[model samples]
Target chain A: MTAAAASDTAPLLPAARLRAALLADRAATLTQLYRRTFPAVERHVRRHGGTAADAQDVFQDALIVLYEKALAETLTLTATPGTFLVAVSRNLWRRELQRRGQHPTAELTEAHFDELPADESEAAPALAVLDYVQQLGEKCRSLLIGFYYHRQPLEQLAAAHQYGSVRSATVQKFKCLERLRSAVRAAWARTTDLLTA
Target chain B: MRPELTRLQLIEQHLLGPATPADASAWQLQTLLDPDLAADAAAQQQLYAGLQLAGRQQLRQELQLIHRQLYGPGSAGWLRGAAAGLRSLFKRRFRR
Candidate 1:
């Protein structure tokens, strides 16, 4: 992917270019922000139960959140790139889950979990949670993976799954858990009983 | 032979570890973790091993996808969708 070849074909749709084309006064700041923060946002959006479609949507939304916050010029960085990104991704996921009326757990954005340093040693080996969740059916697997990994609220789960409400979706959550359990068992070459842990 | 447990029981222990007094008394999950099931420890270990393997692989693939999406002209597993759009644009004659 050569940038020259890319520009030769289509204008860059990057944050830097988009800010330069659309906004006033904050172009340089936006570019620097894009360079500094966009990667973290992009990576988290990709892994946090979003498809490329979802990834693009979440990344853009988080950027907008940052943009709006920059009004105060206090969008400080208490956490590293990964934590900030995962936090935003988790919130977006919760909102998406809520819209669907599922029971997304408040546990989705566990501050303690996010506060942990982003050590490659502790980071799950996969490139992104999205790719791992891809191993399952998109609709079911994605929602389940969202809950499994991020604890997206049940209301959000229902919305994402299109269930009637949180309770109805809760049953599905159990089922989703069963499915995840099965997946882990099969992948591990373990029997169903062994999943008891 | 290993014993069976409910989804809730499994999840509680899987993510939270060991039966809480409340969990054991209320759900009767205490007996579910039978010592006979101890024989199945290998399976439990295997499940964790698999989850980690799958998780890491997924993460690797996703990062690659992001990398391509950012650096390349197209997204992962989605270039085919763009090709047709691009083909039509090529047909739109710029001023001769």
Candidate 2:
């Protein structure tokens, strides 16, 4: 079956509904996506001499890219979600091979080349700072994440988190952000010192 | 509001929102004159990037959990049945 026809049996989800389900962490919708798209990714990876575990890793990263694009309201699908997922998975797997110093047997088509997401070279530093986020205490972490990443409205966040008012939640979010900024600064300084030492 | 918090808000607005050209230029001038403000802005920008990365990481973990539930040895009965059907179909189509 063609990649577009791969997930034909699974009901197609509207892009908006898919975004909402992902943002809300709806398990059933995510399960449907996983069921629909994963097989193509697995087949592609296996054809390239990669293991099932490698396919899983590449598939997961592609989903993360898709999720972030949806969150940013920047997802512009020119094909079925299954096709898009397969293309992205192929690109990610190719990049992985290159990173491992293995030449990919399959050349990336122009379409696949354009599907690559953001550069991950900076991800290491960002991930290092993410470790500091955990040290900000659970309340702060949740407040910042709820506001920034989840994009929850301040009024809604206030009610959900038991703050007295939206203003209170806003204040708390700012404070949490400040704390995180300080931690990141400290981490940068430490890294600099280590490099210089 | 505390001056620090106010400055933080200004930096956030400059980075994350549509600042009027006036506001943007003013911010640029402020950062140019104030090294500390520039440093704070850079750090805040990195923090935003980190938050984005963290969000993706959290979503990946959630997806991984779903994947495990669907494919792991203890997957639900109906899911296992469906998977078996799909596997057979793949085998048939991909057989050399």
Candidate 3:
């Protein structure tokens, strides 16, 4: 079956919903684009030491850039969503690398570049920071992961994880997060020492 | 556990976050006054960051699992169903 016939939904807005004469819209086009492209984007971001949360943020940001370009008629997505996002994430990652006094030509040409834009070059430096953070305990890990990385709301997290209430979840999430930040800060401090040596 | 501030109380300030609208001025002032409480708070922040990183890994795996279940070979029944539905539609539209 064609992608246009797939079960995808267009989020209807008030004024847009009233426009019946123009039923030529294919919601699946974008939905299909999201589904098809997101996996590659996620893989690329992850390889760069991005977590699922980071991938989501990168994908969303990449799409937002694409959307704005679409509105301006300057965005032509000849590459699939996966390729486009990988390219964008790579660009962002390279900039981040430069900020850390590192070369921007590492791990960018790994497996994810089968059909990528021709100039693929560097993995993001955020990976090392993420790696260090992954060592915290499960509860703290879950709480911070859900809120900051997954961007999950406190109330929803409370319900999903069976906390007594939103307040409890919020407190728990913060406690866990405190652990993560301290870990990162300490790790960074150590890295600075290594750099100085 | 510090005598001045319980673990839960310290957690509350963290949830309040650094720049929240809750205006956690009192807690900030307290943190400023107590060096030990401040150190514990800093440690908690580090732990929380690590947790956030771990959580994303879980989400990625979960998302992948869900995708596989949706589009796996086991769920290919939808293709046949779609074919039948298409056949019926064409048959009705062309019927005399």
Best of the candidates, lDDT: 2
DockQ of every model listed? Answer: 0.06, 0.49, 0.23
Kindly list the per-residue Cα lDDT of model 2 for residues A49-80, writing each as its tens digit.
78888888878777767766765667877776
Which digits, one per residue and each the tens of the lDDT, describe model 1 over residues A1-197? 22223335555434323323222333444344444555555565566554555555454445444443333233555654335555775677557656445544433322222222232345342323323345666666655544443234566667767999887776665554455556654544554357775
User: Which candidate gets the maximum DockQ versus the true structure?
Assistant: 2
Per-residue lDDT of candidate 3, residues B22-62 (tens digit): 55676677778876666766555544344433543564355
What lDDT score is found at residue B86 in candidate 2?
100
TM-score of chain A of each: 0.34, 0.70, 0.40
| Better by TM-score, candidate 3 or 2 | 2
Root-mean-square deviation (CA) per prediction = 17.5, 8.5, 11.9
TM-score-sorted candidate list, best first: 2, 3, 1
Candidates 1 and 2: which is better by TM-score? 2
Report, for every candidate in turn, its global Cα lDDT versus the true structure: 0.47, 0.73, 0.52
Cα miss at A39, model 3 (Å)?
A: 9.7
- Model 2 ranges with Cα > 4 A deviation: A1-14, A26-28, A97-120, A123-125, A186-197, B32-35, B77-96
User: Which residue runs does candidate 1 get wrong by more than 4 Å?
Assistant: A1-34, A37-135, A180-197, B1-14, B17-29, B32-60, B73-96
DockQ, Cα level, model 2 = 0.49
Q: Model 1, residue B79: what's the lDDT?
A: 59
State the displacement of the C-alpha of residue A79, model 2, in Å, after optimal TM-score superposition.
2.8
